[model samples]
Target: MKYDPIDSQLFIKNRKNFAKYMQPSSLAIFNSNDIYPTGADSTLPFAQHRDIFYLSGVDQEESVLVIFPDCPKEKHREVLFLKETNEHIAVWEGEKLTKEKAFETSGIKTVYWLKDMEKVLFELMTQCDTVYLNTNEHYRASVETETREARFAKKLKDKYPAHSVAKSNPILQRLRSVKDPIELEIMQQACDITEKAFRRILQFTKPGVWEYNLEAEFMHEFLNNRSKGFAYTPIIASGNNANVLHYIENNQQCKAGDLILIDAGAEYANYSSDMSRTIPVSGKFTDRQKEVYNAVNRVKNEATKMLIPGAYWEQYHVEVGKLMTSELLGLGLLDKADVQNENPDWPAYKKYFMHGTSHHIGLDTHDYGLLHEPMQANQVFTVEPGIYIPDEGFGIRLEDDVVIQESGEPFNLMRNIPIETEEIEEIMN
Candidate 1:
């Protein structure tokens, strides 16, 4: 991990909060993510499962965490099972967490090696009447690959058929959605790193620069700032490519008059910060480009204000659609007839701005939040509104991560990053 060690109190608090929601005599288990393979002798970098990290701050593979608040044995209330670390293992692959180190990292005293997991789990199962299994139930999830958590869940159910099964996802969704002070601080660091990268690109971008060149610049800045890199697959779309919505093929050279829409962010200590900014390739937006950019910015600003406590997620988007429709009408992309005759299912604004205006942003880019519930204070979200006009040969998107406040507007985490057209142009030039 490139980032510094986090204060264990944050994880301790998270565990305590989660325990409050669990059924009595229930033990919840969280497993680390599997290290996926790319090919023979090569594997992708290990990404810890966010839920486990949220509760235990164990950021390594082949780890397990069990929380049993009602355990008869006091030491077993919160437990961590880690891969055993030996001198031989340390020499081959860098030091894994020792028992003492695990305790320091997670604030849990009872630590066991993986070799003793079966015996310990058997003992725990005998004492607990219900078992909580961690599963992915994010609103946008479309997972096809069976994860480590899923595989463990299947085996646990098969072996302990009599135990009452419960889901940890619902509890996690609500808990993870609201930001603790420590989490907000970490997320701020992530956004600050992203701002550094975005500022660097402002000066570096120019006509004839390849889209991949800008991507590399962002990665360089992120690494220097102790970030692992992009929170998600970056979109460095130039010109018409921006209209594709998820364009990541950053292979084309930026033309003199075209606009580049960069939807990227940095991840620090497993926390994600999402940002999207559209700038001119030549350091100056044309009259038409400025018009579209400001419109999108206006929509983003208005949409962010709606993220106050008690705001409904679905209704917020509908209101944002109204804002976008007004902007599109002013931009001549939509007319009174276009809106009046438009299908209620697909608003006229869908022609230029199709995607949702906001989503929860945290440990995961599209973080966990139950949309049906009302927004709450300290819940972080991204307000991103874009206008794609392939006919005009450019697209414009402006986004920022914000924290919903107890009163008034949401606090913008990326406030330091330049978003205004004049500010971006001044920095670029």
Candidate 2:
């Protein structure tokens, strides 16, 4: 891992929290993500499953974690199964985690090789009446690929037909939503790295530069700061391209007086930080551009303040819609008639600002947080508001990652990143 070693206490605490939600005499299992194949003799990079990594801090493939708080045997309460490493395998694939290292990485003292998983699991199934299986239940998830966790879950159910099965997603959704102090610290590091990349692009962007050049600049800064590139597929949209919500072609040349909307972030230790900023290509925004940019910035600031505890996700977006409506009205994008005759399903402001104002940002860009539940302190979110004017040939978006506090306003993780029109202009010049 390029990132520094995280204290195992975070994983220990996470496991304790997760175990507390499990039924008595029940065991929960989590599996690492598959190292997917690209084709024959080639494979995509290995990315650890966020759930297992959250609880074990084991950033490797072919690993499994089992949590059984009420186990009769103390050591079996929390066990780790890792792929055993041999001298020949070490020489060919570099060193894998040793038993001692696994213990250090995760707080679990009992470690066994993957070869013994079936035998040990059989013993464990006999002791527990219920089993918890991890699943992808995030609101934005559209997974079609069969993950390692999914495969394990199928086999486990087939082998233990008598055991009552439960979903781990509900417990994890709530637990992972609220950030621990250690997790907040790591997320802050990710935001700081993203800030560096944004600042770099502020100086590197110029008229006639291709959109991909800025993308490369951001990647260079992320690598230098020990981050694993972007948290999500980056959007380096320039001019009318910015109107496309998920534009990532980054092939167009940035003309002078045009705006580039960059929605990118850095990932540190598998924690994600999401940020979005729209800047001018020529180091200065036109008068009309400044007007739209400031309006979006104002909406973002107000929307962030609404992320306090007790705010419901659906209601929060409704409120943000009102804020955006006012801003769009002021910007002359929506007139009185447009507001009054708008469809209730899609308001007049949707003509300009279409997407949701905020989403939970953490391990994944759209992290796990039950939308039906009220917001809580320490939950990090991204407040991104934008106005896309295709007729004007540009778009404006301003976003920041914020932590909902116990009291007062939410804390901005991207506070160091330049957002104000004057500051961005000054930096670019």
Candidate 3:
């Protein structure tokens, strides 16, 4: 791993919390993600499943974690099964985690080779009456590929049809939503790396430069700072391209007086930090551009303040819409008539700001958190607001990652990164 080693205490605590919610005789299982294939002999990069990585710190493929908290033997309570490493395998594909290394990575002491999975699970299944199966129940999930976890779950049910199956998504959605102290530390590091990339781009951006050039600049900085790359598909939309929320085709050249909206992030130790910033291609924003930029910045700041404990995601967006509506009114994007006759389902403010204001950010860019549930302290979110004007051939968006606090306002993680018009202009100059 390019990132530094994380303390195993976080995974230990996560397992303890997950175990607390399980039934007395229930056993939970988690599997690492499969290394997806591209061609005959080529495969895409291996990314560990967040659920398995959360429960066990083993970040390798062909790894499995089982939590039988009520096992008859104490050693069998928490077990890890890893791909066995040998001399020839080490020379060819590098060293896979040995039993001793797996123990260091995870707190579990009973570690076995992956080949012994069936034998051990067969014994455990007879002893346990219920099974907690991990599934992708995320609200935004649209999984098409069959994951390793899903395949194992299907086989387990077929073999033991009488075992009561329970979903692990509910427990994980709540647990993973709230950040642990160690997780917060990693996320802060990710944000710090993103800040460096943003600062680098502020100086590198210029008229006549292609949008891909800025993307290269960010990748160079992120690689040097121990980050794999972007947490999600980066959006380097320049000029009218910024009007497209999911614009990622960075093929156009930046022109003077045009604005570039960059929605990019970095991942450190598998933790994500999301950020969005709009800047001028010529190092100076036009009068109208500055007006829209400031309005978006104001909406972002105001929306961040609403991410506090007990705040509902649905109600929070409503409040942020009101804040954006007032800003749009000031910018003359929405008139009195538009506001009075606007549909409640799609407010007038959405004409300028169509995307959501914020979303949970952690292991994944759009991390796990129940939107219907009340917000809790230590949960991290990205507060991003934008004003897209296709007619004017420009758009402006300002975003920052924030952590909900127990008291007072939410803490901004990207506070060190420049956001204000004057500050950005000063740095670009």
lDDT (0 to 1) per candidate: 0.95, 0.93, 0.92
Q: State the lDDT of candidate 2 residue by residue for 103-133, as single tens digits.
A: 8999889999999999998999999999999
lDDT of 3 by residue, 1-429 (tens): 999988999999999999999998989999999999999999999988999999888899999999999999888899999898999999999889989888888888999998999999999999999999999988889999998898999999999999999999999999999999999999999999999999999999999999999999999999999999998889999999999989999999999989999999999988899999999989998899998888888888778888889999999999999999999999998999999999999999989889898899899889999999999999999899889899999888888999999999999889899988898999999
Q: For residues 1-429, write the lDDT of model 1, one tens digit per residue.
A: 799999999999999999999999999999999999999989999999999999999999999999999999999999999999999999998999999988888899999999999999999999999999998888789999899999999999999999999999999999999999999999999999999999999999999999999999999999999999999999999999999999988999999999999999999999999999999999999999999999999999989888999999999999999999999999899899999999999988998988998999999999999999999999999999999999988989999999999999989999999999999999999
Evaluate model 2: give its lDDT.
Answer: 0.93
Mind sharing the TM-score for model 2? Answer: 0.99
lDDT of 2 at 99: 93
The backbone clash count of each candidate, in order, is 0, 0, 0
lDDT of 3 at 241: 97
In model 2, which regions exceed 4 Å deviation?
A: none
Worst 10 residues of 3 by lDDT: 296-305
Error of 3 at 199 (Å): 0.7
Model 1 alpha-carbon miss at residue 350, Å: 0.6
